[model samples]
Target: MNFSITRLEDWQQVVDKILPQLQHPILLLKGNLGAGKTTFTQFLLKNLGSTDEVNSPTYSIVNEYTSPKGKIFHFDLYRLKDLDEVYDIGIEEYIDNAYLCIIEWPEVYEEELYGMKFHTMNIINSETAREISFE
Candidate 1:
């Protein structure tokens, strides 16, 4: 699925359509800085029945949230230098235990998920709006 949004409220529409289509626990978000990755997540978690505040996990690496379904672990792997750094942070254990894992800047660890099933959402931010592609 793909979407183009000019306003923040538009995120809800995108979230509504994608929520039902979310079959896997792992969701890889790809986009440049300030491209609304975290904004998208905030909407997603709200629709998923979460009451916790959502923020970028850039420095913390991971943030946890709760929902009627189960636990959600949101990760930001942009700061990590390599796979070793990813393993040192216990990325595998988090994914193993999470009900859902939303990873932003997942390039470093993406290959590690070779045969696993996961969803990918890419956002392209332009001067006027943001374009999103989900699969």
Candidate 2:
């Protein structure tokens, strides 16, 4: 499915549309820098009833959140040097136990992710709006 958002306030509507399609705990977000990936994630977490501040885990690699529904794991793998670093951080363990795992820059370890059942969203940014397509 595809969605276009012209403003931040419309993020919730996108989340609402996609919520029912989320059949798996893993979500792979693909986009360039400043393409609204984190913005969309913040909306998603909030919609899921999370009160904690949501930010990119660029340096930390992973950030955990407690929502009214359950635990959500947000991972930013942009800084990792290799796939081994993913193991070093015990990503598999988190994926195994998380209620939801939203990953950014997952292309860093694309091969490893092939075996997992994850929802993929690609965000395309324009001067006036952002387009999100889910697969």
Candidate 3:
């Protein structure tokens, strides 16, 4: 489904509508900064019944949250200078745990994404609003 989010509230609505239909364990949130990527994630985590604060994992590389269904792994690769950085962070171990992984700054290792579901979002301002796409 596709969504056109004008304000922050609109983005939240998109997340609310999409969260319940998710059947995949992995979601690749592709978008530039200030584009509502993390904001959408916050909406998702909250709707998933997570009470913990949802912050961008930029400095820490990864942030984790737990819900009744499974662990949610939020990863930021913006600081990573090399593909090996993913390995150095024990990504394999995380993937093995069946956690729901939400990746930001995925361009760095976009090709490295294998054996997982793919979802891309872009903030489009051409129409006097932000546009988000999901497939």
CA lDDT of each candidate? 0.96, 0.91, 0.79
- Over 1-135, each residue of candidate 3 has an lDDT whose tens digit, in order, gives 888767777867887778767777777777767777788889888888898899999999999998877898998888998889888998767766855888888777778777556666565554477777786
User: What ordering of candidates by lDDT runs from best to worst?
Assistant: 1, 2, 3
TM-score of 1: 0.98
Candidate No. with top lDDT: 1
Q: Which pairs of residues collide in model 2?
A: none
Please, what are the lDDT tens digits per residue for candidate 2 over residues 22-70?
9988999999999888999999998888999999999899999999878
Best by TM-score: 1
| Runs of candidate 1 exceeding 4 Å displacement | none
Q: Write model 1 residue lDDT over 1-135, tens digit each, in one string.
A: 999999999999999999999999999999999999999999999999999999999999999999999999999999999999999999899999988999999999999998999999999999899999999
Return the TM-score for each candidate structure.
0.98, 0.95, 0.89
Question: In candidate 2, what residue range of length 10 has the lowest lDDT sum?
Answer: 108-117
Of 2 and 3, which scores higher on TM-score?
Answer: 2
Candidate with more favorable, higher TM-score: 1 or 3: 1
In candidate 1, what residue range of length 10 has the lowest lDDT sum? 90-99
Clashes of each: 0, 0, 0
User: In model 2, how many backbone clashes occur?
Assistant: 0
